[model samples]
Target: MDNLLDFFKAYDISLSQMIIVAIIFFVTIAMELSIRLFFRRYEKATQHSHTIKILFYLSLNKPLQLATMVIGFYFMAMHVLTWFRFTSFFDQVVTPGVELGLALCFFVLMNTFLSRLKTYSITKKTRTDGGYNNFAKIEQIHKLGQALTIAVMVFVIAAILGLKVAQGVAYLGGGLAIIALVFKDTISSVFGGLIIYLDSPYAVGDWIYTIDGTIQGTVEKISWRLTHIRTFDKRLIFTPNNLLITQAVVNASRMSNRRILQYIGLRYDDFDKFEAIQKDIYTYLGEHPDIDQNCLTLVNVVNGSTDMGSTTEGFFGGSSLNFQVYTFTKVTNWLKFQAIQDKIMMDIGRIIYRHDAEIAFTTMTLDISSEGAEPSPQAT
Candidate 1:
């Protein structure tokens, strides 16, 4: 050390100060290497652990290296300043620079911790039964944590730089109020997102449709201001969260069973077979494996006008004998329900055919009265 210092003494460098700077520089490098080595070993050892893999995604090695470098730079700067007889600059600039660097390190560390915590929460929830029920809530909390982390870091950096934190916060509050006024719709959508988190009306992957039938799709994502839905046609829709709150939504995915309701009409000539056909259809539904026997199942002759104003009085004025079939299928999947419904409909048709009945279609009969007919004037 003496020889190294003496070598520089020719330029009037202080031996003791030079030695201290050298020590600081070596120590910084050693600390950086140590951190790097430690993290490398830790990563290798825990590579197979799922939890560790997630939590350690944000490594602290770089931040620690920066912190060590900053400390070394501060000490070297102070010693050099003293040698130059400019010690007054230490308090004005060097100290604040060190403080900012350290604060930045801490900010990064907090962010990393928060990120790990969020990953752990999501992992834990996904592993448990019924975890998806609260997934929206967890996402909301994670978003809130990130916002808070940033806000806190800003305040800390302000304080470190000799700014009055309270005054700055007051100014920020006022600015936010102005922003809110200018962006009322945006703010409302954010609140709507919060409501969804609390109410959990629907989660990602739920098939939903509006009561008015204007929108029908599967929920892809829910963010602060918008919810993404992928329509059946493969188009993506970005709906403002506020709209979801105001409109009535039906979560089709939650239905216990899919309904099959139909009105089957038979030709008036088949009126004699109506009772037998209805009985046979009802019996078939009761024995079907895909139908939900526990639900209300009906196969009845329509004796009067239906609520939809369809008259079923074949002998009175109607053209055909009408009967209604109402039942539910055990499967709620749309494709599977269609298959079951098709099979049932074909079977019903065969049953009617066996009874010598034909499904009815609209018909008209033309009549010419001899007394009122003028002989087609001789073909002109």
Candidate 2:
């Protein structure tokens, strides 16, 4: 022990300081292990309450362990630096860097905790007002916190290094316009994202259409700069957030029911049974399980497309009487509603067939008279 003391003394580390550092190292390890064991026991003890267990896991365990280790190391280094009288270099370089690193770690942990808490809370609530993810608001707050952290770190570092902050501020002021100009698009997009998050225009998994119908798809993701859309044809498009803000968007996902409107044409011969057909079809629509009972359901004859005063072109060749069917489905799902619609149409066709009626067809006929015709020379 005497020889070891002499060796350390010669190397400028007194035996007492060496012992203190060794003790700190071992104590840090012991503290970390203790924290882990404590959390484990606490978890077992509080297993009946999931929320409490989650709170403990999220808030206390990791942060406490990290803080214990970091504080121990920081104080240990300070003690050594003080003993060695390395104040100049320590104050200028090491102190600021360590403080910045600690601040960053704290903010990162805080951001993670808040994010997890938000996710848990939102998931438990059964009601949704507009969008699927409520986390976007939380994400905005986290980003703002990180930005403030960075700004504080910059000021702290400058003060530690003895730089004149006022002069730096002046310089930044001079270049502010250029910076703003360079980042105008990016800044606009960021604000646009914030507006989108706050306004709840649309959310991921929602089907939206631009008012002009140029863009229509399900929202896949919303990022800082762009919103991704996955179209029905399996194509993916990235649209700027600002453009979405400026344009009008219609969210079909918000609709409570799907509307079905159709026109069915029958041959002129079936005109006599039109009254029966309309009544029967209207009754069927009212009885259909998938059709919304509370909404308006109509079955009546409208002027056919071939009506003299109308200009709408008929898919059926020229002249045919048409009946209109308008109803709303109870469900908004496309596939399920399509199945219901198919069955209804087939039933309508069956009704027409049962009445000895046929669907209209386009036909043409021609006739000629040969009373005064000339013969060709080759016929002689």
Candidate 3:
């Protein structure tokens, strides 16, 4: 061992080099840690959230750290500055620079994404007063951002691997196209989700009823594959985004309340009680405290569209005398709507019965005789 030490000494492996290497070793560890510590200090000193503070500082310092690590290699190699030129300086930055950039980028992305996720988790619970369309859009935003980040990662990796940008894109373009075509439903769903998002449509918790005999329900979730809704019947419905985007949608929770315009037809024979019946119905709805008074609330004659084939227009004739009431109730929930409706209907039945009004129905009378037709009491 003594002889080996003498040999190393005689070979002119200077003690200075040993001391320098040692210093570099310690400093390298310090460099890695102190950089983190310094950022942490500033991050902790502020009123901002720890995550946000780190995020803000990271954005400014990531590239700077890469530059510093390149500088550290000089001290680590124990090389003299007179020999190292700009070309050598760049060379040192290359290996470490590539690694540092990707690491920093990924960290920033993850941290920011997590911060947004946390913010979403907390704030989404706050009453947006906006319908499920807006809420669904919130989730969609995060998902789209994640997808974009993933794509960026793919591009960056290809770039780092010395692949040309165009070549990388070309290599995947056809595959992506075929994949998109295969999963065309999913791609269409994203577009539909975006339509709902950008157009201020429904969110993930609104009670809605569609025209296609679909009843009202609470929107449960909006995903890339489907938008789920929980019906008041405790049933779950998965609607394709394409159906929602292209078809008609009614957002019941859009306003602070709901406006219900309904019709009740009475037989023309009981027309004598029309005035009194209208007054009673109007008074009851007016006195209801849960109804919004700010909107129009009086019953009036509403003309249907001019199309004779239309149900509304058809209802206009035959002495139907449709009385349209424009009123809004404070409740938008399905249960509350039903409860209010039941109360109103019960009251209406009582009033209609008291006035001896016959509610109209589609009935046909057949007359039968020996040769012709006459009504038969037995059939009744």
Candidate 4:
């Protein structure tokens, strides 16, 4: 040990400077790389093969290597200073120059990897279902992470290379009032995206019932700026995500299918014969390969009023069958739902007609005795 110290002194090294050199070699470089390599090998073994594996490793290795080089350079520089008795020069010369640049580079690299790690974690969480996500939400997150990483790297590297990012920040802050006035929607949208990810009220393919009377058929897509819903009628509705979050959303397809109800009214006079009429209708629907269950049907309990609780009869009145067919379509497919409904309607009409019962229609009877004075052609 004494000989090594004497030799370093012979080669121009002080005790404190020598200690820094050893620390940089063992701690900053050797130990750091050893730890990184250990994790790398372990990760490669356990993780499934992907085309991105090579690129990911290279990305990590580059920083690991660059860090090693940086520390090694400092060690060499320290040795020079110690040997030449230039310690004062080292402190005076390196701080504002080398140290700042080193620190900035480290910060940028560390931030980039941190961003990547977060992206990977979120991707894993999104794949909790293990089923393939056609929506590719996780993949999109990864892409966004990549973009942000590059942006941050560019920004920091620019400052390190002496482009004065702090000056830019100052100017930006000075003009923030103008920016806010001009880009209010843009700023709000960024915050809205954060809320979306945190709250996760609904995902793609969910059927959302808006409180404002608009029934969004399915979530076609969701972006940072907008949420798109495809209506049952094949129309697309683009809503700002911010506005959507503020509104009440009824998620029908959240872990389950939606329910649809239908009501049909038959003439009140169809009764007595209605009991037997319901028999075939119920049997067919019960045995139906598509109808959900035997829970779908009803007989005539016709209240003598409009079907929709209308107090006045306009051009319609009848002894209605008052059939309440309630069946859930097993699938969330709108087309399938409509097809099943059409079949049910057809069957109901055929059975009613086959039973020789008339579907009631509105009627008005005026006694001719009182109207004889003016039996107008319009009335006739």
- Which candidate's TM-score is highest? 2
Candidate 2 lDDT, 250-296, residue by residue in tens: 98877888888877778877778878878888888888887888999
- Writing each residue's lDDT as its tens digit, candidate 4 over 1-380 gives 98987788687656787676777667766767785787678668756643345335534654656656665777677776768778887777754456555655555565556545544554555533222223335435644665576667667656655678888778868898788789898767756756775576776656777887765677876677777889989999987777777778877655333254555556766766667776777676677666555344343343444354454332224334465555554454556667777887788779878988866654455756664496669989
lDDT of each: 0.80, 0.74, 0.65, 0.63
List ranges where model 2 is wrong by over 4 Å. Answer: 1-7, 14-16, 29-62, 79-84, 87-98, 125-176, 212-214, 267-269, 302-321, 339-380
Expressed as tens digits, the lDDT of each residue in 1-380 for candidate 1 is 87976656755776687788899889888988998888788768766674744454544766787798899899889888777667778988899889989888876776676667666666666623211233566666667776787787788788878789889889989998999999999999999988987788887767889999988999988888999999999999999999999999998877878899987878888878888898999999999998889999999765566532344353233566677899998877777788889999999999999998898876777886789666676843
Query: RMSD to native for every prediction?
Result: 7.1, 6.5, 10.1, 12.5
lDDT (Cα) of model 4: 0.63
Model 1 alpha-carbon drift over 4 Å, by segment:
1-138, 141-166, 212-216, 302-318, 354-356, 365-380
In model 4, where do residues sit more than 4 Å from their true spots? 1-185, 204-209, 214-221, 228-238, 251-255, 258-260, 294-321, 364-380
lDDT of 3 by residue, 39-88 (tens): 56765675255454455554444444554565566555434332233456
The 10 consecutive residues of candidate 3 with the worst lDDT sum are 77-86
Ranking by TM-score: 2, 1, 3, 4
- lDDT-superior candidate, 1 or 3: 1
